[model samples]
Target: MKQIKIGVFGCNRGGDYFRSLLANNADIVAVCDKDDFWLNKAKKRLGDGVAYYASFDEFIEHPMDAVLLANYFNEHAPFAIRCLEKGIHVLSECTAAGTMAECVQLVRAAEKSKAKYMLCENYPFMKFNREIKRICDSGTLGKILYAEGEYNHPVASSDVAFMRKYKPYAEHWRNYLPRTYYITHSMAPIMYATGANPIRVTALPVFAPFDDSMAISGSHCGDRAAIITTLNDDDSVFKVSGCAGFGAHGNSYRVCGTEGQIENLRGMGTQVMLRYNKWSKPAEMESNNLYDPKWNHKDEALIEKEGHGGGDFLVIQEFLNCILEDKKPPFDVYFATRMSAVAILAHRSLLELGMPYDIPDFRKEEDRVKWESDFLTPFYGPNGEAPTLRCSSHADFTPPEGPMKAYLEAIKTRE
Candidate 1:
């Protein structure tokens, strides 16, 4: 067995994968983060065997075959590009690019690199979601037509602790994140299950700012969620949320086809509900059947011990398998960039009051030419470049001064 050497960037989220990487027989060669707290945490877990660095410039110079990018939500593309430039494999977390130009740059970098790039999107590997894909692939669902996914996570207004930890500073990316930005959790599973690529996207915002009296929030966007709709290459339509904060906290998905429909039961753990017309129900199956899914994976024990319904473990396993086998990952650079395009354009649609935007196919030179110079972004740059665009549907919306002050105070107390 060839042990793949891997380094991780951003220990805060990247450290979560240390055990999984070790379980898959990958050597933890190096780890890097700007924060001493996170770097020290990684040191504690990986022991003194791994080299640690506080500067990414020096970290990337370390000898490693691949790098797992679990950095900030909006800053993966530039780092991934640098890795690809060095012929280092990349397993990126979540949305691949923060802007259209970065999307173009990422595609170009991957095309020119010998090493592969994969989006570490784990939602598709969830037990029930995998079952949904199985049923879809089995032809029991007939021709897939429409699907829906919702990732609702609503924190309590009084959870100042969360604000202190995640949104520690006013200029943090999370503080300025649009409702449609954190989209992969709700978008990837349906795309994987149905084999659909989004061609067009539009969205509407669910605007409901938190009460300043109860919550200490520094988030610039007041929208609770973005209801995004996509028209796919397969003629199927997908409706999903972008990290919603509405109703109850749950991750739900549904796939409806010509003959039948299936959905994972929210608040019911791994159980799924499958339904079909009497004439369309398959043999030995009821018109309406509900059951919990079985893992049936070789790494079931190790997977069960991990997070995200065991998806975290499977994602690492798949990435390593791809590397060792000299195969491209299913969630390749193209797939990742496409998802980022949908997210970026969906937010544009929300700002435009639901004006649809065509998703460009970066594989086409014409499409790449169209967006190569489009660098508009809603995030502050590392050098403090101001955002070129607004993040919220309400362009003038900002957290009240009282809440902002309280939020800063809470973070200071934590320090």
Candidate 2:
């Protein structure tokens, strides 16, 4: 097998995949990052053999077969387009594009380029999620009618260390991230399992800002979660949350159909609960069965050691397989853009007090034209452009002055 030469951008997050990439026989030829701390950290893992650059302009010029874009959350599309134009395969991290305009541009770039583009959505590859997909594919679940996914992640407001590290500057993307902007983790698994494409979306915010007495870290967003509901092409409904903050930290999913339903038991560690009507149960099967899922993959040993419930390893493996086989990935450009559309539009729905928005299908020229000039965003741009949209549901809401000052002071103290 020819070793695939790959470059990683954004060392902090990208470094997490070093072991998995090596285990999959990929050569890490180059790495790029703006932060010297993270760059030095990457050096410790990759040693002196790998090329390092602080500028992507120079890094992208390196000879490589593909690039894993783990850059900023809202900045993958432009870089991915450049990789495609250079005929290099792109494995982009979550939230493929920041704006509708970029989504259109990415779709066009992928259509014209010879290289393939894949969204690295790992949650769909998690053990229980894979099992859910298997059951859904087997037709034992009957006609799917509804599904739900929650990626609740709550952090302590007192964790100034985390704030100093992740949301370093006031203008950082994380500070202005809307409740519905990080939807892939909560949205992708259900979509993948049931093969449902969301056509319409509506959302409402759970506006629970951190207490004024605590350090609010200069974050513009005050919403703890966004309850987003989508109407799929299959006429099914799905309810999901995007990086929610109002619950105990855990991911949970449930899929219900005409005759049966299946869900991963929360806090159960890979256990799944499958239930069916007595009359609709599979032959000799019980009406309800709860059990732990099996990895069942040849790389089970290696996968068990990887992150995100063994999803990180499987996602990379799938991306490499697609490149080797000269095939498009399941989460190809279309799928990625669709998810981004849901995320962007869902936030707009929240802003409008739950007004539904139609998700554009980039494959169609008409749909592409509709969003071609839609560049509205809730985040600050690379050049420090002011946000054109509000990050929180309450337009007048801002981080309290005292908390913001304390947050900044805490960061300075660490420095």
Clashing pairs in model 1, backbone N/Cα/C closer than 3 A: none
C-alpha lDDT of all candidate models, in order: 0.92, 0.93
lDDT of 2 at 67: 98
Write the residue-wise lDDT of candidate 2 on 1-415 in tens digits. Answer: 9899999999877999999999999999999999898899999989988999999999999999999999999999999999999999999999899999999999999999999999999999999999999999999989999999999988888888788778777788998999899999999999999999999999999998875685556778889999999999999999999889986889999999999999999888999999999999999779999999898899999999999999999999999999999877999999999999999999999999999999999999999999999999898888999999999999889887877887777766433
Question: What TM-score does candidate 1 reach?
Answer: 0.98
Judged by whole-model lDDT over C-alpha atoms, candidate 2 comes out at 0.93
Best by lDDT: 2
lDDT of 2 at 299: 97
Candidate 1 per-residue lDDT over residues 210-303, each given as its tens digit: 7568577888889999999999999999999989999999999999999999999999999999999899999989999999989988889999
TM-score of 2: 0.98
TM-scores of the candidates in the order shown: 0.98, 0.98
